[model samples]
Target: MMIVTTDQVAGYEIVEVKGYVKGSTIQTKHIGRDITAGLKGIVGGEIKGYNEMMTEARKLAMHRMVQEAEEKGANAIIGMRMQTSTVMSAAAEIITYGTAVVLEKIN
Candidate 1:
């Protein structure tokens, strides 16, 4: 499947609009990692643990979004976007969204 952040994809024409598709997940920081993050805050540096967690969250969310698009019989996804927000202390929500569409290659 092809994915783009814009409304149109190059070398292809959108034939059918499959509407909106989205996927989301919520994650909480592990206590051990949180402790490490708190200590790192004192020195002010990148939090590897938190970084890894968020990275995995993004991958999972994207995978789910793609799965939804496949179910909708979409060959491409346009206007792909990601959103993140703090749901609670030590927890955050990750969301992936896009417009599912069937595309035909332009010859």
Candidate 2:
């Protein structure tokens, strides 16, 4: 499906607005990874482990959001956005949301 951060997609007209669609997932930090991250912090470098974890979480949330749009017969999603928050000391939540729409190519 086509997804954009803008409200409009070039050459395509939004025929129907199916409202907002959202998906979220919660993830926890691995203890081993946390230890590694702490060491990396002291050394002053990028935290690859946490970065990978959040990247995967974001992808999963986006997938679910896209699935919801597909289920509603939407061909595209506009105004796509992501939100994140820590659920606990070790866990965090990623939320993906967008406006689902039926788009038709403009002739």
Candidate 3:
């Protein structure tokens, strides 16, 4: 399915609005990785472990959002956005959301 941050697709017209669709995922920091991240932070470098974790979380959340849109027969998702917050001491929640729509090629 097509997903975009903008409201309209370049060559297609939104034919139907199918309401909001969303998906979320929660991820926790690994203890071992956290130790490594702490060391990295002290050394003043990028925390690869945390970066990888966030990247995976983003992908999972987006996948779920698209799956929900597909389930609703949406051809595309517009105005897509992502939000993240700490769920607790070690866990973070990532949410992906967008407006589901049916699109038709404009002649």
Candidate 4:
């Protein structure tokens, strides 16, 4: 499937709107990683553990969104966007959303 941040995909024409599709997941900080993060925070450096966690979470959310689009018979997703929010003290929610659409080559 093709996904783009813009409303239109180059070389393709949108034929049908399958509606909006979204996927979200919540992730919490690991205790061990939190401790390491705290120490790193004191020195002010990149928190690799948390970074990796967020990256994976984003990928999962995007995958789910794509699955939904496919289920709707959409070949592409436009206006794709991602959002991150603090769900709780230790947890964060990642959301991926877009407009599912059928696209045809602009032959």
Candidate 5:
């Protein structure tokens, strides 16, 4: 399936607007990783553990959003966006959402 951040896709015309579709997941920090991250923070550097976690979370969230779009019979998703929020002291929620639509190639 094709996904884009724009309202329109090049070379394809939107045939059907399937409405809004969303997927979300909550991730909590591991204590071991937290300690390591804390140390890295003190030294002012990238935290590998958190980076890996967030990368995985984004992939999962995007996959789930795609699944939802497929269930809605959408061949593409437009205006795709992702957002994050701290849900608790150690947990964060990541959400992916967009407009589901069917696309036909322009000849």
Candidate 6:
């Protein structure tokens, strides 16, 4: 499915609005990674473990959002956005949302 952050897709015209679609997932920090991250923070470097976790979370959230759009008979999603929020002490929630729509390619 086509997903864009803008309201409009360059080569496709929106013909039907299927309304809003959203998906979310929660992830928590691993104690082992936390320890690694703490040491890395002191040295000031990228936290690969946390980065990988967030990347996976985004993929899952986006996949769920796409599934919802498909269920709604939407071939595309516009104005797609992702949000990350700290839900608890060591947990974070990732949310993906957008307007589901059917698009026709312009000839």
Per-residue lDDT over 25-93 for candidate 5, one digit per residue giving the tens place of the 0 to 100 score: 999999989999989979988999999999999999999999999999999999999999999999999
Q: Write one digit per residue (lDDT tens) for candidate 1, span 22-95.
A: 98899999999989999998999999999999999999999999999999999889999999999998799999
Root-mean-square deviation of Cα positions for candidate 2 versus the true structure, in angstroms: 0.8
| Model 4 lDDT tens row, 1-107 | 99999998888999999999999999999998999999997999999999999999999999999999999999999999999999899999999999999999998
TM per candidate: 0.97, 0.96, 0.96, 0.97, 0.97, 0.97
Model 1, position 60, has a per-residue lDDT of 91
Q: Which ranges of candidate 3 are over 4 A from the true structure?
A: none
Clashes of 6: 0
Query: In order, how many clashes per candidate?
Result: 0, 0, 0, 0, 0, 0
Q: Alpha carbon lDDT of residue 57, candidate 3?
A: 97
The alpha-carbon lDDT assigned to residue 82 of candidate 3 equals 96
- Per-residue C-alpha lDDT of model 2 across residues 1-105, encoded as one tens digit per residue: 998999998999999999899989999999888999999989988889999999999999999999999999998999999999998988999998999999999
lDDT of 6: 0.97
Q: What is the C-alpha lDDT of each candidate?
A: 0.94, 0.94, 0.95, 0.96, 0.95, 0.97
Model 1: residues with Cα > 4 Å off, grouped in runs: none
lDDT score, candidate 1, position 69: 98
Q: Regarding lDDT, does 1 or 5 come out ahead?
A: 5
Each prediction's RMSD over C-alphas, in Å, is 0.7, 0.8, 0.8, 0.7, 0.7, 0.7
* Residue 18, model 2: Cα distance from true site in angstroms: 1.3
